[model samples]
Target: MSNLVLFTELRQRLDDHLDLVSRVAAEGDAESALSMIRREVPGLVAAVHALVDEHLPDDNGSCRKCRSGPFWRRIPAPCRMLIQVHLAVGAAKATTRDRTRWSPSRHRLQESSVD
Candidate 1:
């Protein structure tokens, strides 16, 4: 699959997981919610690895085409910025946390700190 498509799917899956956690938390079943989140952790980590494997070129971590092709000799600045933001967010979320208190605002703050 194309890198963009794969990334989108992975992101969507993450969102779905977060949404489920939110719903379960609202129900006040913190223990069960935490259990489910722990169960999903491995899959989320794998998905992140998959994204890196697909997006980063094997040799130098640059896009193969953009590195060699005449695609303006650059990727658009906005896109590069977005990728940086996404990666920063990912890094922030790497620290394991108690899912019982995993609020979306907290998730976003974690992501933003990478900036």
Candidate 2:
């Protein structure tokens, strides 16, 4: 399949997974929601990797293509948002040693510290 088509399908799947997560949360099934999110992460990362490898250019030292206009703009918004969110989450995870540091109480502490 073409990269665009694959990206569109992956975005749809990610949307569906997000809906499932919402439903699970509403049903008070935190464990199941977390499990579903964990399962989806690898697929999301793989999709992002595939798209990057396909469309992005490998320069000698600089990323000139990424800074250029309209290439990334051709991608759908949902796919872009998913990629951004995945990167943000990955960065957040990397900054902390314990994943459990993302708990509600810790979040509140972090928020307060920012202010």
Candidate 3:
């Protein structure tokens, strides 16, 4: 599928998943909500990969050795911008998990300081 069409579909899917996640969270089902969000990640990654492959410059094929280096610069500006936005969204999603993992360490530090 074309990038525009794929992007639109992905956006809709993401919205729907977000709504479901919110509902599940409200219902006190954190595991289900997290599962729903995680399930959508692979599809998003695949769509982005397809977009990159479709937009890569012709010279990209010859640079197989340094596969990751130059290919991103070849993607069109709009697609690159979309990718950046997606990455930011992913990082935002990960923040909750990061915070959860850090909470124990933070509590331990607080306890040690109190003594």
Candidate 4:
């Protein structure tokens, strides 16, 4: 399959998995949620690390993967990808600190934390 197709399929599959986990967390046992976390979290962390590594600045302090403009203008260090990560993490932290309800915002919290 083309990369676009593969990426779409993978994103859909992950979305479906998240949906399943949400259902499990809401209706199933805690043990099942904990088990799923144990099984999938390490791989998820590794994937995030791989993306971070790919986007990291080169020796000249330009993003390795992201560029724009006719001359391919360099995006400086801490490119959009890393900045989004920072924003997501900040949102997640703020959300967690302010959260009192779990039933309504489960997926939002998870998405922010893992974005």
The top-ranked prediction according to lDDT is: 4
lDDT of 4 by residue, 1-115 (tens): 8999999999999989877865675567889978877887688779789989999887878888895564357899889888777655555346434542233323233323332
The sequence of per-residue lDDT tens digits that candidate 1 reaches over residues 7-54 is 999999978877786467446477887887678667867866775554
Candidate 2 deviant stretches above 4 angstroms: 1-14, 22-28, 60-115
Model 3 C-alpha RMSD vs. true structure (Å) is: 11.0
Q: Where does candidate 3 clash, by residue pair?
A: none
Residue 19 in model 2: lDDT: 68
Ranking, lDDT, top scorer first = 4, 1, 2, 3
Q: What is the C-alpha lDDT of each candidate?
A: 0.57, 0.54, 0.53, 0.70
**Candidate 2 minimal-lDDT segment of 10 residues:** 106-115
Which candidate model has the greater lDDT, 2 or 3? 2
State every prediction's TM-score relative to the real structure.
Answer: 0.43, 0.34, 0.35, 0.65
Off by over 4 Å in 4: 1-6, 22-28, 68-72, 93-115
**Segments of candidate 1 deviating more than 4 angstroms:** 1-17, 22-28, 58-61, 65-115
Clash totals for all candidate models: 0, 0, 0, 0
lDDT of 2 by residue, 1-115 (tens): 9999999999999789766764674465678868866776678679767766544433432233344455554443333434554555654454333322233323321322321
- The worst-scoring run of ten residues by lDDT in candidate 4 lies at 100-109
Better of 2 and 3 by TM-score: 3
